[model samples]
Target: MSTRIEVVAGRRRWTVEQKLAILRDAFGPEGSVGDACKRHAIGSGSIYTWRRQAMSGELGGARPAPLPSFAEVELSAPVPGLPTAGSHIEIELPSGVKLTVDSGVDADALARVVAVLTR
Candidate 1:
């Protein structure tokens, strides 16, 4: 006999949208019932119940907006004396901190600085 194990987070209540998402993932492409159960920390029983409910029209389901799997990015070698002072990037943090950096700023270094600030 397998005992169901659940991974609980800070929030216990799951919204209808979340439940539908779990159901979709449980049976969508790359569907593996056991793997889905383990990944979501939910039980196979619950998945089946949701499936039945959906099929019987007991549950109202909506097709979520499809998300793009990947985006095209262009990377080019940096040019000298480029990205003049006038070209800048600005980001506002939740705590009202305004961060401004030049376009030529190193992405990895800027990411590290942002990570430290967010923490």
Candidate 2:
């Protein structure tokens, strides 16, 4: 004689938004797909499918594209009050002109612009 076990299925179906939310939380800085699967009792394959859909633009509400490289940005004059190449406490432009620039400005581009301005 053998005994049989019955399984009860979940009543709710997850929507796209819900799946995205779960995926985002699951893949956040402190989270991982494996951890999420283990915690939520889900399959690893499902997480991968969601990731593929997200990457292929099938999912909405995704993060925007990254900034273009320095090589891609057009070179321009430095803004007033922007830091230029120099030693501590001194704004040293190749031409000795002080200018202000936004933080995270490409140093290489700045150097090239300074050289042109000095010449």
Candidate 3:
């Protein structure tokens, strides 16, 4: 008696649509790169390659939009007698983008400003 062994050859090909869908899910809330890779049975390297292809317009897929990032703001009790109105927070992004928000600015309005600036 002999045991039979079969070998599979060739890499799995992913469609453009499938790549886009997986990327979208990965960027969605509660989604992560590791989780997406495990769920899709794909490799992290493949995901990066797909992302590069998408960015370079070689994938014929929609380019991933830059997601808005928000930072938590905590207003510590004004130092001694510092006027709150004159107090503003300055945020410097990794891209060297700077944002200054007044202490009394509306939260919603500030978020909108940040969303636009980051994009």
Candidate 4:
């Protein structure tokens, strides 16, 4: 008979590459998120968040894209003489904050924007 012992201390940190691999398996045709989560000993929420970050280009990889960043937004009232035309939509947050954005806003960008606004 053989006996082995292992000791673990501190929180586990996952590297970008590891995260990417886990995400690939979680989302791959032959793998499921539940399976990946169990196999990697991580929560589904973490995997989903990593996937979201990966999509927004926060985690660098072969597919390059813009990183999520916050910019100084200047909110001004519409001039009385000017016409509010073209394509624009109003989004009212749960906190009762209204935002006017272009109709063609990117989905990922909009999601990040909404996350910030909600916070």
List RMSD in Å for every model shown. Answer: 15.3, 12.1, 11.9, 9.3
lDDT of each: 0.71, 0.66, 0.76, 0.79
Candidate 2: what lDDT? 0.66
Backbone clashes in model 2, listed as residue pairs: 81-100, 82-99, 82-100, 82-101
lDDT of 2 by residue, 1-95 (tens): 99999988975466788777778768887878878888766787877887777764555655634332344554498767744555233346533
Show the colliding residue pairs in model 4: none
Off by over 4 Å in 3: 1-6, 61-119
lDDT of 1 by residue, 1-119 (tens): 99999986795565667777888888888777898889888889888987877754556655433322323445487567556555988878665789999876776777777666654
lDDT of 4 by residue, 30-81 (tens): 9799999999999999999999888666676545433345454443976665
How well is each residue in 34-68 modelled by candidate 3, as lDDT tens digits?
A: 99999999998888887778765668855645656
Rate residue 1 of model 3 by lDDT.
100
Counting clashing residue pairs in each candidate, in order, gives 0, 4, 0, 0
Give TM per candidate. Answer: 0.39, 0.41, 0.44, 0.45
Which stretch of 10 consecutive residues in model 3 shows the poorest summed lDDT? 61-70
Collision pairs in model 1: none
In model 2, how many backbone clashes occur? 4
Off by over 4 Å in 4: 1-8, 61-119
Comparison by TM-score, 2 against 3, better one = 3
